[model samples]
Target: MCGIVGLFIKNPELESELGRHVSAMLLEMSERGPDSAGAAVYRNEVDSGRIKLTLFSSQAQPDWSAFDRQLRDFDAQSTVKPHLNHAVVETSKSLQQMQTWLQSHAEVRINSSGKKIEIYKEKGSPASFIDSFKVADYTGTHALGHTRMATESAVTTEHSHPFSTGDDLCLVHNGSLSNHNRLRENLRSRGISFQTDNDSEVAAGYLNWRLQEGDGLDDALHHAVEDLDGFYTFAIGTREGFAVLRDPIGCKPAIIAETDDWAAMSSEYRAIAQLPGAAKAKIWEPEPAKIYSWQRQ
Candidate 1:
């Protein structure tokens, strides 16, 4: 099993509290997952043309200067900020070109990239890493987090959840997909590459492939329910909005709470109860095969 938490703030006043709220929610569900933890934070975009790439290196002390120089070789200007085991690089190059250049390197892996999204994840406990990373200090419009128990994959950072396959689009899944091996082969044949063997990564790739075909978030999720064979719950976050969907059988646990200020969802009510106005929020379990989406205005 895994723990999933998402928060979308509608009130401008609550924007700065996005990370704090999400951090609390994630810690609340720490017992559900002890293998790895991750989070995708979406903040206001200061540079429309630049993309923020969150990268991971197996080395505790990575050669960030060399990586920045490599980006410059591609005619892209960049700024690198190193965290504990990950780094966030903001570059002016197009996403396609940037990805191509990064793919050639063996040591670095791109976690997520977009104008507003910055992803941070590692192979460790959520409660321990959350404070060290100062996750509560981040400010964003929306955010999603995952704590993985590692049912099908190894307990490595690469196998962590909140997988990102496109710009500003990330997915965190609970439960397993039985047909993921078959689906992975199909996606690979379509020219879609996967970084990890994790089933959750396949889910992200499937959504990215659908979105590339001109499907909107809602439409893509509708197709996902029909195409992907699994007993799962998905909490996806994009630049435009946040969405939640459950399999037709509804085997995985999910709860949603919505107040005038924010919309929050988690594996259990205790996670959402930590929110500012959760006491007065309308809370319920999402129905099976139904799409619940909230977009930013």
Candidate 2:
């Protein structure tokens, strides 16, 4: 079991508190999945020509300055912002180029890569994880949070939800992907890689694959409904906004609500209730195989 929450801020005034809202939603959904939690915040944007990579250091203590120096060696103009175990590195180099050089540094892993997305995860309760990352103070255009029960994969921090396989794109899923093994191999052949045996990663990889093939978010999700064999509900976050989709069987629970200021999706209504405009938001359960998305102009 797992709980997924997403928020897209429509009003610029609410952008500064994006993470506060997401934190409440995530904590509210913790009853469904309290063991591990993660959040992908779309903020701290780099220049359009550059990219931001959130890196996680597995070492007990890492020298962020040395890491920054390595990045600057790759791109003299690169910069870094260090958090606890994670740091956001910005550079003009292509992702492939960065990943190629990082192949040698096994302890530092790329958590998420984009101009505006920063991801943080911990193998603890939602409340503790949020506090550790100071998620409530994060500001962003949109955010995706996930609390996981980890039925399939190990309950490790790296195996947590909100997996990102593409730039400025991340996915939080709340159900099992039945054919993930086969799908994983297929994606690997197509040049997509997996860091864990988690099926949710496969789902994220599939969407990234579709996107790389020239499909937009809506089109990629439509393809997902047909090609992905599972009973799942997914909330996907991109640089522009977020999307929600349920599988054909729709066995998993999902609720969507939208108001004048924001749109939110969660595994249950209680989580949505944590939002400011929930009392008057237009709420509904997403239809089977239907793709619902919101984006900024």
Please report, in order, the local distance difference test score of every candidate based on alpha carbons.
0.89, 0.90
TM-score of each model, paired residue for residue: 0.96, 0.97
Clashing pairs in 2: none
* RMSD (Å) of each candidate, 1 decimal: 1.4, 1.2
- Model 1 worst lDDT run, 10 consecutive residues: 68-77
Off by over 4 Å in 2: none
Instruction: Give me the candidate number with maximum lDDT.
Output: 2
**Per-residue lDDT over 1-297 for candidate 2, one digit per residue giving the tens place of the 0 to 100 score:** 889999999999999999889989999888888889999999878877898898998886788999888878879988888988888888888888999989988999999998889889978899999898999998989999999988888898789978995889999999998899999999999998889899999999999999999998899998888889988999998889988899998899999999999988999999999999799999999998898899999
Candidate 1 per-residue lDDT, tens place, 66-126, comes to: 8778777776478878887688888888778877887777788889988888888888899
